[model samples]
Target: MQGKRVVVTGGTTGIGRAIVRSLASQGARVVTLGRDENALKDALDAMADLPGEVHGIAADLATREGVERLFAEADVRLGGVDALVSNAALGAEPIDEMADDDWRYVVEVNLVAAMAATRAALARLGKGGQIVIVGSISAEIHAPGESVYSATKAGLQGFAETLRKEVEERGLRVALVEPGTTGSDMQEASDDEQREEIAKARMLRAEDVAEAVDFILSRPPRVDVVTLRLEPRLQELP
Candidate 1:
């Protein structure tokens, strides 16, 4: 991975953060984005000793302008892009229970932003460039009370699958990583509850998903991992 240039959205915390660290450790130059300025600073500081260079951009993916700014900074920081990881997402309450604006913001962040980022990256990506979308198993399970969130994920599932076929002719690889019951800031479970579940092999850590991403990118140019689903050993489905 040495000297590879990559971009990762929503990379200041949770799974995205883990992916950034993993890539940096292997000497990949990465530009990552977050909505929080402090989190962006912290993420950059934390990677100071890694072999790879890391840059952080504070941008709100919920808006088109923010997405534009992110890629603009990426273009300046990395010069060119080799991989783009669309990992930013927002969890939402049930559609009926949420305020109209709130639900719409969730869609903007979780779904629309991904599409925008992918579009920008495709313009810059060349043959052998990788696009990895961090999706969720909720799209498949469709658990109750996750109407809005599930809808966005289901949209990503279709987006990633269809996009892969469209870009395969160009030698661009697209992969989707769907994780189930991950312990992240977006999780509703308390810290103790999450820890207990992790210990029981019923919940996955953010780093687990990061590793899956690294594996996908590490594959030979001839190999394309279309989709990889990761669930804890004891995770139960609705």
Candidate 2:
């Protein structure tokens, strides 16, 4: 990434932050987006020594308006985007006991927001661009009580497949990277014993997913890893 321009949404903390650091270290001009003002400032302060330029845009990624604003701002700040990582998403809310408000928020952020960003990114991203939609293993399994979340990821999988074909003519590549139970904000939301149990088993590190993104971006233009399912060694379904 000597001069590559990269954009990572939801990049203030957790997996998103890791991706920002990884790309910045490789000399990519990284622009991060998220709603956390303090966290983003803190992240940027901490990465003061990275090789590439680092910038942040604080915005609500749960709406189309915010996404459009982000892309427009990115155009002024970075000129054009060479790679995009759509990693921000609302977690799965248990469907049986889900609140109506939570359901709407879930769909807006997880599904609609991603769609909006992808649409905008396509316009700003030039030829030879790489788009990676971070997905989950839950997209494949019928996890009890995570209907909306699972469905959204499943939908992303399909969307990536379609986008890949549609944009191939312009040398654009789109792919899906699905990881199982990554070490992220979601892991911290659980208790120690529960986290340990999951970690000791097969939870992936967010850096690992970031590494996958790095690999996808580094590939030759003619080749694209269309889909990847990243699961840890200790994970086994009952």
Candidate 3:
């Protein structure tokens, strides 16, 4: 990944932070986008000692303007992006109880922003460039109370497939990663006892997913790991 210019969204925490660290350690020039300024600073500080370079930009992906700002920042920070990771997303409550505003917010971040970013990245990416959509296993599991999240991820999967086909002719690669039950802040949102039990079981670590992203980015131009599913052995099915 030496000198590779990459952009990662929602990269201030959790799985996204791990990916930024891993790639930067291996000589990639990574630019991370997040909505929180403090978290962005923390992410950069955490990676200060890494071998490669990392830069952060604060942008809320829920709006088209924010997505545009992210790419604009990438242009100035990295010159041109060789790869993009659409990792920003928000989970939603059950459809029946979800407010209209909340539903729109989730879709805007998870689906609309992802598509918009991909389009913008394509304009800068040349042959051999790659795009990885950080999706979720919820798309397959379809657990109750997560209908909106599941729908977004499932839609993202379909989007990736069509995108791969359209961009293959340009030598641009597209891949999707589906991670199950990662040990992130999301887990902390649950009750303390439930969170403790899940942690004790050694749920999939953020680093685990980061390693997968690293592998995908390191592959040869001709190779594309279209869909990679990462799940902890101890994680139960929904």
Candidate 4:
């Protein structure tokens, strides 16, 4: 991964942070984006001692202007992008009970932003570049209270499938990594005990998902990893 130019979204915490750290630690030039300025500072501070180059950008992917700004900065900082990790997303409530704005926000962040980022990245990504979409196992299991989140993730899966074919002739690879019940702030545990329970054998750690992303990116140009699903040993579906 030495000197490889990479971009990561939602990279202040959770799985996104892990991916940033992993790539940067391996000597990749990494530019990560998040919505919070302070959080972005903290992320850059956390990587101060790393051997590779890592920069933090504050941008909200929900807006077209913000997305364009991110890509423009990437052009200036990284020269060209070799890999893009679309990891920014939020959990959502049931569709029927969710307000219209709430539904739109979730869709814009999870689905639309991913497509926008990929579209921009393609302009900078030459042959042998990679696009990794961080998805959720909820898309496959269809958990009852998370209809909106599941629907968006399912849409991402479809997007990745078609994108791989569209970009195949260009020597680009598009892959999806869907992790189940990861231990992160996004889990929204109610209390300390609940957090402990969720952190136990029932959940996959953020590093686990990061490792999946690293593996997909490390593959040679001739190989394309279509989809990877990661779940804890004891996790079960109903």
Best by lDDT: 1
Q: Candidate 3: deviation at residue 157, Å?
A: 0.4
List residue ranges in candidate 4 displaced over 4 A: 190-195
TM-score of 4: 0.96
Query: Cα lDDT of all candidates, in order?
Result: 0.94, 0.83, 0.89, 0.90
lDDT of 3: 0.89
Of candidate 2, the 10-residue stretch with the lowest lDDT total is: 186-195
Mark the regions of model 2 whose C-alpha exceeds 4 Å error after superposition. Answer: 188-201, 236-238
Across 1-238, the per-residue lDDT of candidate 1 in tens digits comes to: 8999999999999899999999999999999999999999999999999999999889898888898898898899999999999999988998999999999999999999999999999999999999999999988999999999999999999999999999999999999999999998898899999999999999999999999999999999988899999999998888
Winner on TM-score (3 vs 4): 4
Error of 3 at 61 (Å): 1.1
Clash list (residue pairs), candidate 3: none
Q: Candidate 2 lDDT (Cα, whole model)?
A: 0.83
Full ranking by TM-score: 1, 4, 3, 2
lDDT of 3 by residue, 46-73 (tens): 8999998998888788778888888888
Q: Which candidate is the best by TM-score?
A: 1
lDDT of 4 by residue, 1-238 (tens): 8899998989998889999999989999998889999888998999988988888779899899878988888788888899999999998889999999999999999999999999999988998999999998888999889889999999999999999999999999999999988887687774474456666778777888999999999998778899999998778686
Q: At residue 4, what lDDT does model 4 achieve?
A: 91
Supply the TM-score for candidate 1: 0.98
lDDT of 1 at 91: 85
